[model samples]
Target: MSGKIRACYACQRNGRLTCRRTRLGEPCLKTYPLECVDLLKRSRVAFQAGRTLKEGFRLAQLEAVVQMLEEHECGFVDALGRDLHKSTTLDECLMVSEPLGVVFIMGNWCSPVQTCLVPLVGAIAAGNCAIISPSEYTAHTAELLHRLIPFYLDNECFHVILAGANDLPEVVELRFDHVFFTGNRKEGSRIARAAACTLTPVTLILGGKNPCYVDQHCDIAITAQRIAWARFHNAGQSLAAPDYILCHTDIQAQLVQALKCYLIEFYGSDPRESRSYGRMVNLEIFNRTRDMLWRSGKVAVGGQVIEAEKYIAPTILTEVVESDPIMQQDVFGPVVPVLTVNNMDEAIVFINKQEKPLCVYAFSKNNEVISRLMSETSSGSFCSNDSVLQSLMVALPFGGVGASGMGSYHGRYSFDTFSHRKSCLLRGTRFECVTYLRYPPYEDRNLSLMSWACTLSQRSQGWCQIL
Candidate 1:
């Protein structure tokens, strides 16, 4: 209505939204947050044009993501460090691979960049338009993505939505072709429910209290080092990180000592001062972790907390009962509780009693012990003699089961998650007369011939092996 202001003509004309903004004399530096309707319109238009159906286009977009990662590697690392107090020296990285049509991806603050972009890659590969709604908890990384994604990706097909609390209400109300979310069970359930309202299919990459079973036959030293590195690397904020340990009582004391030794070895005598050690992502997580730690159990190894710096030492709690506060829920922090079981059977029973986990890690030299656990468990994944290492293998699917979450993605799995698997069957029309053998009269000779035709035997043991 004034010289300083003008209605958002682009949104008004092309989208089901009315956005008014001021046209400053100079280049406007402010990012105008796209309305839910506007974001949907752009993606829908791209989807209808079949931009995603081109295999060449999908491959190019995938290449572009790799280029984006390589070109802006330092910037992403810096943002991760700023947001999660991540250690740059740590060489480990996590990614989830997938794609979908006019998709909405809601990432978590824990592994902000990886959780968001990995799925985006899958979506792109599957030839789907996407709107990435990054976690507000990691504001800096979100801001960087907002600026960088458009520069590398096809702007008409991809978008980064960054807005305040009020923006979310409108988002869940809009319908999407698919919704991919990664976060806690509570929030993940909420997102799934919201997606259901629109009759939209959803793939929830959720978190849970994954268990690590330490058998007496395990190489305690190696197990300890691996657990310490895996659990505390990202301040224990990883969804797949071992949440707690169920150790054989015979080796519980020694296992605790070994774990203590490794934590100090990996981080330092005081992890807070160690450059390799990480801190809590923010004050809210710090406080939640502190409370969980306080009520968890007696701190057997490290128990220091510096809330001001959002630091929680790589802490292990012993003398923890199965009914303890920390044991009952997912402890997504640098704090793990170790509980002792009389034997492998006790450990198995304890694990079976709880909700299915994302992963169940067992460390043992005994092949039988490993086999038993593998057969008995019902997790999305299980790793014997290792911890969360399978996630790095792009060939393997990364996801959870039951209460942990549903669906999976990584490499081919990611591509499949975003792409519909339509079954196609083709038959020769010239063979119509032959089909009458099994119809109408349905003679015993026709049945015999049909059965014989379908029957076959193995050519070799390679074709059919005894389990």
Candidate 2:
């Protein structure tokens, strides 16, 4: 468990590992060999033995997880701070459902702790054996979890595998009851394809380019402040953050000015000097984000990028078009692009033309404006007059729609995601007379009686009541 391992050059060579450029030179990451088949066998054996099925056992494991988080809070914080340069914390079932035997969870790098632990929590609560692979890009956090999880949870039932992207193809080939993945669309597609070969169920939480509309009727200052906070937080690494702004042309200038002021207040004149702001996860992300900032639109606000720091200032791009490089992909950085539209209808049309997003946001004081945006546009979720707040609450089920993602999870939804609702019915021998009618050779009278019994009718007026 010593932190003396070498940097994972293998991870960087793979095209899939895009989130791994550390600020102060890459840290050494501990990776495991591809022993997934044996691990899956162990998990299956544990599930069959019914060790995880017991309520007491599940509760104990869950409690252990809470204790582990509490005991090693600083360690986790330090690991995450190193992995993604995060500065803050974010804070998530159901039916007569049983465990889905085993769950395979692949966490994302944006919020490594949350993406990994939230699904793990649900899997444990639902009484399933789980195998988790934290993002290799988030090396420190992944290695820390690999070390800490086995100590807290049952090593046989809940296992952590820290492997590079090259190992994923073989890992997904092995069978599991359910597969839960939080990542980009390309990698998620590959996982889906592999899972499909085994006919395994999957939940993909893929991030997309979420759009936010700014109406002339809204308070520009408040709207700008909320957008800036939501967009610039975590260096705009959040999947739920508003990707681009669609503002009315008349108020576009005002909104841009307001956003500039708020950005200065949130991260000071120089965001690179601000401790509250974070850096990109890796060089790949930094380069991609920087390219978008340079190729698209005029830089109305911060558009600075320091390659060595893997830093992109909290930037705002104006005069951006739909075809811009930034608009084409999920701008998973602290860059907010603005596209001016003549009105709400034009904005709606623009939004509808693209893939549905994780969430759709609209800022307006008018209730009708909010209602129109919510009703007309389709997304995983809709937030009015604000951004990124809808997915924070555990009460809300978080997910994406269409190309964005599939399935929801948070609170009870997570429990459901990892569980199989097995319907059951028990009857006594004494009730044999109630089923006598349909047991014999079928007759017209029997059909009539069955139909009457099944019909929904008022009391005392139906044959069901008489029976």
Which pairs clash in the backbone of model 1? 98-122, 98-123, 99-122, 99-123, 99-418
What are the lDDT figures for the candidates, one per model? 0.80, 0.84
Q: For residues 1-467, what per-residue lDDT tens digits would candidate 2 score against the true structure?
A: 33222325554333222225433466546333335333544776788786786678999999999899889989976875565452321110112688999889999999999999999999999999999999999999999999999999998999999977667757987989999999888888998899899999999999998999999999999999999999999999999999999999999889989999998898888988888999999999999999989999999998888999999998889888778899889988999999989999999999999999989999999999898899778999989988888988889899989998999899999999999997544333553443566677889988766554443233232122212
- Measured by lDDT, the strongest candidate is 2
- Scored against the true structure, residue 282 in model 1 reaches a CA lDDT of 83
Model 1 C-alpha RMSD to native: 26.1
Write model 1 residue lDDT over 178-219, tens digit each, in one string: 888888888887778777888888888888889899999989
RMSD list, candidates in order: 26.1, 24.8
After superposition, which runs of candidate 1 have C-alpha atoms over 4 Å from their true positions?
A: 1-100, 163-170, 427-467
Candidate 2 clashes between residue pairs 3 or more apart in a chain or in different chains:
21-282, 21-283, 93-412
Model 2 misplacement above 4 A: 1-95, 456-467
Local distance difference test, candidate 2 = 0.84
Q: Which ten residues in a row have the lowest lDDT in candidate 2?
A: 86-95
